[model samples]
Target: MAILMFISRVISLFLMVVLIFYKRKEPALLMAWLLLLVFLPPIGCVMYLLFERTPLPRKAGLFLNDIKDERRGRQASVSLNDKITSLVHFNENYNSSRLYLYQDFMYFADGKSKYQQLFKDIEGAKQSIHLQYFIIREDEVGRQLVQLLTEKAAQGVEVRLIFDSAGCFGTRLKYFASLMEAGGQVYQFHPPTFRLIGLNYNYRNHRKIVVIDGRIGYLGGMNIGNEYMSLDPKFSPWRDAHLRLVGDAVWELQHRFLKDYYMVCDHQEDERYIKDHLNHYFASPLSTTLCPMQIVSDGPDTTTDDIKLTFVKMIQSAVHTIQIQTPYFIPDSLFLETLKIAAYSGVKVEVMIPTIADHHYVYRTTTSFIKELREANIDVYFYKGFLHSKIIIIDEELCTIGSTNIDQRSFKINYEINAFIYDKTLTRQAVHQFQLDLENCLLVDDSYEQNKSAWIRFEEKVYRLVSMLL
Candidate 1:
């Protein structure tokens, strides 16, 4: 048996190395895999088989994106060169759809108030409505919102909803039965089954978008739960921020919602959802002028990874400063390199991560980055309270705010969306809040190591290795 085990290990190791080279995965990661397979052949083979060569559901998600409308195909075919020429300061392709309707924008500073605004929006919806969330818990907050969605659907508002499968797995399936009964449609994105057993388990739909009457849209990191609203007994006084986007951007979010809707529900649009319901609020040359915002989304299906590319572009083009606040800070090699180079070049980079992480492992990895970043002269701030805001302010002119966090999961795995803003007023508006949050934060520079226990730092090092998967 021992001899046979050795023979099997040799065969698997040979195949794994051959496949890794053939696939052309990152050189460093491939080397790591080679080392892992040499020592732990069976486990490494399983990992590689499940991910790099798992030719089933993954292939399906890759080749089988929903068909875009004929209108969309035509629009997509057009060269955005004209739009690009006007927005020469920033990449024109990153600009938001000029025709997408968004009028006003509101910043929800308090997390709980986001839910309050949601309830009011639901109450006021006249016609069609679409709402999507990553985590739809069965807790107090979830039950209340579910009941409300049912009521709205019953009123013939064309209500539809969706949630992430893994995120809502613990919540009882029966809790949402009312939604179906009221002609409400709810579907889960990338539901985990026996088939999809791999590293991609972390790829979640992190977007929190609520579109009403094709008008008002809300999105950001805040999920639907009492913990987010401080109604959950487990966590208290939830602190987070969500953006209320009105005008042309709302349609883009609505378009995003429908894409997910089609993926999960496979339902066709109402024929005229766009004709009558769409309210394209384009920016004028002055009050609104080509504010050039793009609703960039990233996930497992695409190779480009829009959010990650956007980060790379912004970091590469940054002129003065970059401020980032995220719940989790587990970026891969390229992203980390970007930040290190920006800081090393004196770009006044500041990153605010929670002093105490919601996920303990995430917190550990974040501190490890802090130790390195502080060494490179980047400002690191720790918030005393739980910080759930996910935003980036660059050069006080370009800003990004949305549900996406700066982590591997958000960049390469999760179905996340963000609004990239170029307008100076919006940047200032977000930066003002960032400044206030900075006031509440404790800076860590030249002294973080002296205050920590050696054992704690050791734990952080161990956790940092797993951050790629976390």
Candidate 2:
């Protein structure tokens, strides 16, 4: 046993040296792992082994390359404001997200309205329906969604669904047996290989997207659950944001869904199937409204942090005002610095977060940044109820809404998506809604941190030390 202990110490030291060299660029992440190793060597080594980064399957890359080759020169050029032109160009070059003119943009601040419209669209589906969510509980809402998709599949409409295994941990594959029996396809995103070992557990697919009939698309924060509708007493009055987009933008969403589908779908199936259905999946729609939008996505499969960089660009372009709402606020150093710079430049910067705690360590880590953020002259507001919306509005002319939090997890670990809208009308609508939410918020002034109990402050410090892993 003494020899075994010595060997473990040697291995841990070796791992730490290797990590310091390999992850030198990510200082915060590297520090978090180093702290973990110092305290618990065995557990930290096992975690590092399980969660180490690896590129996406080679077959997935080949599939995306073929699709990219076919999609070249398909995007239409559009005139954009000088301030946002660089931001748009960055997303196009790095994320390969094309711009589209959406005819209709409907924003939902409540889950009831969003799910009602989503179900209606599903009922009206004629050809295909693609739905993806990070969580799908075994509750009334989840069952209803499965039933609806089963009915659509029974009606000869192609129905495809993807859910993250880690997010829906207790959910079994049998939960989707009925949908599969009805001829609908359901795939779990990166399930565990062994009963106790899940290689992709740390990297989750956090995107919530829906595409119906190649014409309508939805993407945002609300997942499929009764809690999202405020039916759960623990998290009553749940607040979130979702977007229902109609027009050519839906084609971009459809393309994104197909890419994820191809990643998990059987590669043994004839590749000709995707080629044959390309036109059907990307049918163009004629619309009059010119609402410029870009559907941007990022994941751990690539090295580029596209969404985080896009957020940085958006904050940098701010001239008059910036408002951000997110449940989690454990941002990286760069993100925190950008917001501080914006405030220093006289941009009215405001951020709203929830007063409640869903995850104890994560919530504590979020509060840990409050003192630093407040010192930078940024106003911080704690919503009276649970605030789950991931939104950022700039100058009442541009806004982003989707399933991305202001944290390292969303920026680097999870598969996330967001819609960057560059329309004055839609952006102002978002700003107006944000103002309404602010009425129920409690501002954190100079004395807010002084009143905190010693225990609470200590918890924050402990959590903040390893926040990057959260």
Candidate 3:
């Protein structure tokens, strides 16, 4: 028995060494994993296997390989006014995402308005309706969505839905049974089978998108849940932002949905069947409006953090002011330092985060970061209500709104998508909304730190230490 125990210990130590050195993770993340592995060997190994050590889904890998040759020959041309050429070119070169000129834009600052518009669009769908969300609760909102999709499918309009398996864990299969019976296809991204366990829970599909007939697209922070509509008593008056876009930009959104749909449903025998049916969705008629936009996406599948780099570039290009709104504010070192540099360069930096705690660890980490920003003379606002909006406006010339948050999880882990809008008119509207939201926020200054007790400060330090994993 003694010899057997010694052998087990040696094997575990060897595994830990491999994990610590072989994985090319950030220093902070590596240290966090190392601490876990050393202090709690058995539990840490399970945690690492469940969360940190998985690759992209196998079907997604195969799909990417199949498209590699086709994508390599794809053109990088886009029609954009010279005013936004530099920024558009930067994104194009970074991720090969083409800039598209949209005809019209509708901004929804709350879920009620956004859902209303989305339902109307879905009701009017002619050929197809594609919907994807991180969360779809088994609540009234979710039922309504399923019923609508069922009706549309029964009417002979092709409908496809995708939801993150972990996000909708509690939702039973019966909830979507009726929709499937009506010929609507439903896929749960990264569903936990017995063989897979819950290994992919950390790498969620955080994107929220809906494309209708390949002509109208909606993308932003609002998920399909009653809580998002402020119907849940636990989180009433929910704040969020979503956009309804029409024109060539919708083509990009449709393309994204197609790729994700194919990846999720790649096991189907007729792989090219859906592709052929949806080929018409990519056709874009000429549009006259000049609202330039790019849909940027990133995930563990790709090594490059395109959205994070884009955020840094936006901050570096800001000349006068930077305004941001997000539910969470646990920024990584690079993002934090960029904001500090921008603030020190005579640029006004303003950030708004929710005062309420959705996740205790995240809330504590946010407070710590807010204190750091305050010390650097960067303005921080604690919103009175729960602010779930993810928005950023730079110099009233560029704006981004979507599921990506300014945090480590969003920057390096989860799958996220954002709309980079480069139009003065749309940007000014976003700026105006940010200013209005300031009315419900309390500014944090140097004195804010004085109220923290020694115990709370220590707790915050501990939380900040493990925030990268959070």
Clashes of each: 13, 0, 0
Ranked candidates, highest TM-score first: 2, 3, 1
Where in model 2 is the C-alpha error above 4 Å?
52-58, 64-77, 194-198
Please, what are the lDDT tens digits per residue for candidate 3 over residues 1-470? 67855554565586668766776777877788778767766666666556663446534424533443332222344555554677787898998777666458899988878888888898999899999998898888788889999999999998999998877888876789989999998998878643343365567888998988877889999988888888877676678898998877777677677778776785675455655654446545435667878889888777788999989888888889999999988888888899899999999999999977888888888888877787778899988888999998988888999899988888877889999998888888888888888988899876778988998799799898777655
Best by TM-score: 2
lDDT of 2 at 314: 95
Candidate 1 whole-model C-alpha lDDT, 0 to 1 = 0.70
- Name the runs in model 1 displaced over 4 angstroms: 1-11, 49-102, 196-202, 231-237, 266-291
lDDT of 2: 0.84
Predictions: Cα RMSD each: 4.8, 2.3, 3.2
Native RMSD of candidate 1 (Å): 4.8
**What number of backbone clashes does candidate 2 have, counting pairs of residues 3 or more apart or in separate chains?**
0
Highest lDDT among the candidates is held by which one? 2
lDDT of each: 0.70, 0.84, 0.80
